[model samples]
Target: MFRFAMLTLVAAVSAVGAAQAVVALDPVRGATALAAVWREGAPPPQVQDRAAILKSADGHYWAEGEIQGRPVRFLVDTGATTVALTQEDARRLGYDTEALVYGQKVLTAAGEARAAVVKLPAVSIAGASVSDVDAMIVEKGLETSLLGMSYLGRLSGFEATRTSLVLQP
Candidate 1:
């Protein structure tokens, strides 16, 4: 009876230990966390050491920051009439692009497609604050999104000085 009880206790302890394994999510270290899981030998993400944050000489602007603790690279594009993101980036932001109200037909490099318009409550760039910024969450196979005039135009002044874009809001 004593041996039987000890065996049962060992089994229960082993089961509990197996259940407590903790899996870690490293945004910088997990490069293909989105792209692959089943595939073999995906590269590990190297955390970026931003030397200088990006700002544009053009009117549009964005600051590199964490979205759900992941690295994001943004560009200021005044040429783009509206704020836009590729479909994949939107998904990373926890947005289902297909379900959002796609309010416009945009002329993209590929072709015309439905684009969902969204307003970001707060977007800060280089210690500057801009609120209620009109933005878009794009859907799949995206090159990149342009932080465009729709958001930048609302700023007090967006100008190109010598080396940097001056954004006054």
Candidate 2:
């Protein structure tokens, strides 16, 4: 009976450790603790170094990010091959739009638009940063700044769910 009880205890401990291991690997580490409370009716676990989580509203995941060391809101877009900025956003980031050479013709959802291709000194999101990123400044017809592969591609990984997006830096 003693031996059987010891084996059961070992199995229980292993199972608990496995659960924590799985949670540790999650992109949004805080979600693990939140999920534990939601799933197992336990208290929320203390989370450290949690990943930034963005919830989708209106079918888009928006995030707060930094570009050129300035705060900007981003529309996380995996479809975009490179980061795209609106003329106003570029100005907000202290770019001289009048001097920007709009020589690149790029096709957009709004048809053909002339864009200025520029190398960003650095782009950071959720503490992960990439320097010398290629980005395009759309002079017209684009509403929001896009956080594209130029930035997202630098991360170790990111995960998307139906209602939320997790950025791992």
Candidate 3:
């Protein structure tokens, strides 16, 4: 009688194991069942693609970016139409300040100034990057390089809080 009871228990266990094996073989059905169980719990956390720039002590958003693989510091300026590079920064990026044609006249905080339009092969800040970006080399009156609309406009979105500028690429 004991041997018969042991055989019955073994058969029951084998049947349960076979049932689980069958369920595991069908991935779509297993996923559907998992989704149903998951619905009862809190939703999974979403993945966010974003970068942030903290406000500087000078009360402006500043970012460390790269141009032609060289590091550059930029002042985030939404007011500017295109990225504005100072003569020093342009030189640092290997641009010959003397050769660039400064025919475009632009109004600056100091006064009117001449600028030379140039196309950057690539520019990247944090994780956001852009190719063939329109930029200008300010002949004068630009204290720092400006990260302007030309780069920001390509992003999915951006927002400014009192403490930081959040970039969504």
TM-score of each: 0.54, 0.66, 0.69
**Backbone clashes counted, model 1:** 3
TM-score of 1: 0.54
State which candidate has the highest TM-score: 3
Q: What is the lDDT of candidate 2?
A: 0.57
Clashes (N, CA, C under 3 Å) per candidate = 3, 0, 0
For candidate 3, the lDDT comes to: 0.62
73-168 per-residue lDDT for model 2 (tens digits)? 666555455777778889989999999898765554454566788999998765666789888887775666767667766766666544444555
Inter-residue clash pairs, candidate 3? none
What tens digits encode model 3's per-residue C-alpha lDDT throughout 1-169?
Answer: 3345324423432443211110001223431110000001111122257777775554445678889988877766554457888899899999999999986766555556778889999888777788899888878876667777778777777766555567777
Residue pairs in clash, model 2: none
Ordered list by lDDT, greatest first? 3, 2, 1
Quality of model 1 by C-alpha lDDT: 0.45
User: Residue 25 in candidate 1 has what lDDT?
Assistant: 26
Clashing pairs in 1: 87-138, 87-139, 87-140
Query: How many backbone clashes can be found in candidate 3?
Result: 0
- The lowest-lDDT stretch of 10 consecutive residues in candidate 2 is 32-41
